[model samples]
Target: MQRLYARARRAWDRPLTAYYLVLGGSLLLTALGLVMVFSASQIEALQSGLPSTYFFQKQLVAAALGALLMLAASRMPVKLHRACAYPLLAASVFLLCLVQVPGIGHAVNGNQNWIQLGGPFQLQPSEFAKLGLVLWGADLLARKGEKRLLTQWKHMLVPLVPVAFMLLGLIMLGGDMGTAIILTAILFGLLWLLGAPTRLFATTLAVAATLGFLLIKSSPNRMARLGCLGATDPGPEDQCWQAVHGIYALASGGWFGSGLGASVEKWGQLPEPHTDFIFAVTGEELGLAGTLSVLALFAALGYAGIRVAGRTEDPFVRYAAGGVTTWITAQAVVNIGAVLGLLPIAGVPLPLFSYGGSALLPTMFAIGLLIAFARSDPAARAALDMRQPVFGRMRAGVRRKTMRRRAERPPSGER
Candidate 1:
């Protein structure tokens, strides 16, 4: 055990560790999510008179597109990313505003945060808004830091806080408290990363908490969701139906689970089995072992993101990475906690592991952002440079072997 720990420590100390962890962990979770989505959504799709593969096919296409986006993001220069900050944020804001327009906007499960794009496709602006806030907030702070303006409380909170509140207000207009919570998390994350004074942080937290409580109190649906925490009964009118079923799914999974694709809950007992409650289905089918594996992947991804943030010299990279980390981590905890009955069901999808193109696309791009930052590290860059020749030689050796085998082989026609 000691030897293993030492070996792991050494590996963790390597320059490229963060890069590989971010890449590998994100990919693994995505792949697993695709499998689970297929398994969990088939029943729902068929029941809706669609092909069994409908949801999975859509998710597959989204994953493909997201992969391309991630690759492009990873290859982009830091300057290009910074340049995109304002435009992306602008686009996100525009789309978010569009979602509030009667003819353009669409609601799903009471959240008026979507825009229907012809035929089975929908755009969720809030998802992109999360990304927008991270980039814009980071850039804002980075510039302020460079100007030494962050020392003043007003400079730190002025535009950033106001703009964040604007975005939050827009989101709340759609009645998406779940997303609102995530946006608030990102806001606090940015402030915390900027090393806000304790008093300011406390004040901000208090205000957020108060606003959240008021929001919850104002909406019956939101109130019911909050009241469902740790609830075993389905409540009057089955308000806790989804929550209770989620727990049931996990409870039945035991230690090793019932095996993949065999979840009974997905057969109509559980709601949103492929999206928000996918974790419960995962626990049911893959058991504690599978759930733990998923948790481990998230832990690795979060740890890698932290390493990237801590090791970076660039202020933008540090703030951006920290913000992304906080966003993903907070969302995951809320999602999994809700499934476990430890928290209220927030309607947030598990990051990189749920069936939502809007969520997955931005998240994969964020992973790419981490990858880019990891590569930017001086030591990581040097290590990659050192590895080029070895990889080239290996490729050359494989080519030579293939050529020799081809030359020595009988022609297809002659055989």
Candidate 2:
């Protein structure tokens, strides 16, 4: 057993290990999400007089688009990503503001965070804002390090806190406490990664807690959800119905599960089975084994991301990887915790496993950014080139194409 463990550790120490781990874990989660979405949505689709595959088909389409974006992002140069940081941030802020337009912004479940594109199509600016904030914060902090300015708490918080408040203010204006919470988590993670002073963090934490309390207290819906926390019996209160049913869904699945497409709660009892509560659907259909597998995959992804952050020499890579890791891992914790009744239902989607296009696209793209960072590692790049000779050939082919194009062009003004 000791030898086996040693061998495994040695293998994991390889350069491309993090890359493969992230790729494998992401693919697995996406595949599981597709299956679970189908299982959880079939009953609801039929009840709505639509084809049983309706929701599943939509999810599959979104996954396909996300995959394409992921691929493109992975191949992009790291500098390009950094260069686009401010622009992405600006666009996110603009979109968030646009979602407040009375005629353009669409409300669903009391959250006016969606901008209508067309019938049955809406874009959630908050989702993309998470990515923008990650990129922008990472770049900003990395720049601070270049000037030796990260030592002081003031330098660290200067633009970050104010900008974070701006984003949070916009999200709150739209009544999306869930997205706001996740955004706050991202900012906290970035600051922590930047090594903010202990006193600063303590003060920030207290203020954050106070603000969180105020936000929740201000919302009757939020308060009602919180009231379900220690309920012995939910007793048919609409607020607790979803929470109670989520627990029931998980309970119904014992060791192995009720089997795919066999969840009773998804048939009618559980709400948002395909979205915020997909984890419960996963448990109900695939059981304890499935949920554990999902957990393991997320754990692997988190480990790989942290490894990239630690091993990289680039400050930007370190900051970006750390921020992205925190965002996804923290979001997953919020999601799974709510499903398991360990935390208040925050209405946050499971990172890659939830059935929402807005969340999935940026998430997959973020994974791609991680891949780009992993590839930036010299050893990883060497390993990839060695493993895939076609990449070298493609580089050569591109050079040849450029040379040929130059040669084919008419001389000076001869054309």
Winning model by lDDT = 1
Q: lDDT per residue, candidate 2, 1-415, as tens digits?
A: 9999999989989999999888899999999899999988998899999899988998899999999998998999989999989999999999999999999999988899999999767799999999999999999999989999988878889999999989999999989988888999999888888888888988887888899999999889899888888454666656688888899999989999999988899878898999999999899888999999999999999999999999999999999999899989999999999888888888899998988899999999999999899998999989887968787788999999999999999999896
Q: Which pairs in model 2 have colliding backbones?
A: none
Tens digit per residue, CA lDDT, model 1, 1-415: 9999999999889999999999999999999999999999999999999999999999999999999999999999988888888998999999999999998999998889999998899999999999999999999999999999999999989899899999999999998888999999999999999999999999999999999999989888888888998899998899999999999999999999999899999999999999999999999999999999999999998999999999999999999999999999999999999999998888999998899998999998988999999999999999999999999999999999999999999999999
Model 2 root mean square deviation, Cα atoms: 6.9
Candidate 2: which stretches are off by over 4 Å?
A: 230-232, 389-415
Candidate 1 residue spans exceeding 4 A from truth: 402-415
Query: How large is the C-alpha RMSD of every model relative to the true structure?
Result: 1.7, 6.9
Clashes of each: 1, 0
Query: For model 2, what is the alpha-carbon lDDT of residue 295?
Result: 97
TM-scores, all candidates, are 0.97, 0.92
